[model samples]
Target: MKIGLYFGTFNPVHVGHVILANHMLHHTALDEIWMVVTPHNPHKKKHTLLDNHHRLEMVYKATEEYDHIHPSDIEFKLTQPNYTINTLVHLSEKFPQHEFAIMMGEDNLRSFHKWKNYEMILQDYDVFVYPRIAENQEEVILKSHPKVHLIQAPIVDISSTLIRKSIQDKKSVQHLLAPKVWSYIDLMNFYQ
Candidate 1:
């Protein structure tokens, strides 16, 4: 089976995330979309993120109804300062029957070269890249690599940051988040 690993912190799982994920899963040859809940992304500040369990639960609520989309806490068990290469190798070893491909945004692809053992990652697995409305992006060689697939999934402008801020500011987020997720956040008073 071919799996597309969609990694994110998911501070609060929003509609844009589900839309893009569903589109990718259905449109591509992938058998499943695993929404990997990143414990602590090296690129992001640790303090700004919600508790790992909270983030994971939100992901569960966001993806519970979908048959193909799954919430993964694989990264939470791995060693800290985890790199993508390490997780890839671990997943391959743990689930030898399945093949894993990275599902990332174009924004991350721009800095793929700077990741730990990026050359090896490119050599080993396919990368499914989605569109993101980003600014000041510079051209990079990896963007044109044969292993990299530029999927035309809908461009998602919504972000976890935007949801967090909106909630903190007492703004309505009825449509931004799944109803269950919003209820969880509201009941817990997260990000406010």
Candidate 2:
């Protein structure tokens, strides 16, 4: 089976995420796309992130009805300051039956060279890159790589940061999230 691994904090799973995952599943040869919920991103500030469990639950609520998309907490058991290379290596060893491909935005691909053992990652795994509004040099790099493929997924400008700020400001987010997730966030008073 070929699986696309879409890694993110999922601070609170939003509609844009769901759309992107669905797009990957429908457009690519991938069997499924896992929304790998990272507990903490080494590159990001820890204080700005919500609790891992909360983020995971939101992902669950958002993905419950989907058969192709799954919420993964695989990173929770891994060591802190988790690097993508290490995670990919561990996943490859543990799930040898499935071929894993890295799913990422063009923006991240722009800085991919800075990642730990990025060269090895590019050589070993296929990368499914989605377009971002921002112009980046990574597009040129990815275009030249045999293992990288650009996917035409609908780009939504909505972001987790914007959703969180809207909630903090007591604004409506009905359009930004699934009803189940939005209700859960309202009940828990998250992001306030």
Candidate 3:
């Protein structure tokens, strides 16, 4: 089985995430997409992040109904300040039968060289990159490495940071997230 590992903090799983996952499944050769819920992304700020378990639960709740989409808590038990190379190595060793690939945005491609063991990642695994609204499409395509492939997905501007800010301001996030996920956030008082 070929799986696309879409790793993220997912402070709150929103509709944009679902859309991208769906788009990838529909367009790519990937059999399934695991939404790898990272406890702590080394590059992101920890202060604004919700609890790891809460973020994982939100991803689980949001993806439960979709057979092709799965929420993974693989990073929770791993070392803190999660590194992509380490996570990929662990997953590959654990699931030797399944071929794993990295799923990310074109914006991330610009900074791919900065990641730990980046050259090893480029050589060992396939990276499927989807377009981001703010990134230059031509620049990303021109800069792509041998392992990288560009995918055209619907560009939804919604982000977890924006969603968190909306919640903090007591603003409506009705259209930002899925109905069930939004309900869960309200019921759990997440971000409040």
Q: State which candidate has the highest TM-score.
A: 1
How well is each residue in 43-136 modelled by candidate 1, as lDDT tens digits?
Answer: 8999999999999999999999999999999999999879999999999999999999999999999888999999999999999999887785
- The TM-score between candidate 3 and the true structure equals 0.94
Q: Encode model 2's per-residue lDDT on 83-192: one tens digit a residue.
A: 99988999999999999998998888888878899889989999999988885443455556888898998987888999999988989997899999999998998999
Candidate 1 to truth, TM? 0.98
Which pairs, if any, clash in model 3?
Answer: none
Number of clashing residue pairs in every model?
0, 0, 0
Report the candidate with higher TM-score, 2 versus 3: 2
Per-candidate TM-scores read 0.98, 0.96, 0.94
How many residue pairs of model 1 clash at the backbone? 0
Q: After superposition, how far is residue 63 of candidate 2 from its true place, in Å?
A: 0.9
For model 1, name the residue pairs that clash: none
Candidate 1 residues lying further than 4 Å off, grouped into runs, are: none
Q: Between prediction 1 and prediction 3, which has the larger lDDT?
A: 1
Choose the strongest candidate by lDDT: 1
lDDT of 3 by residue, 7-120 (tens): 888888899998899898889989999999988777787887888888888898889999999999998989898799999999999999999998998788877878899889
Error of 3 at 34 (Å): 0.3
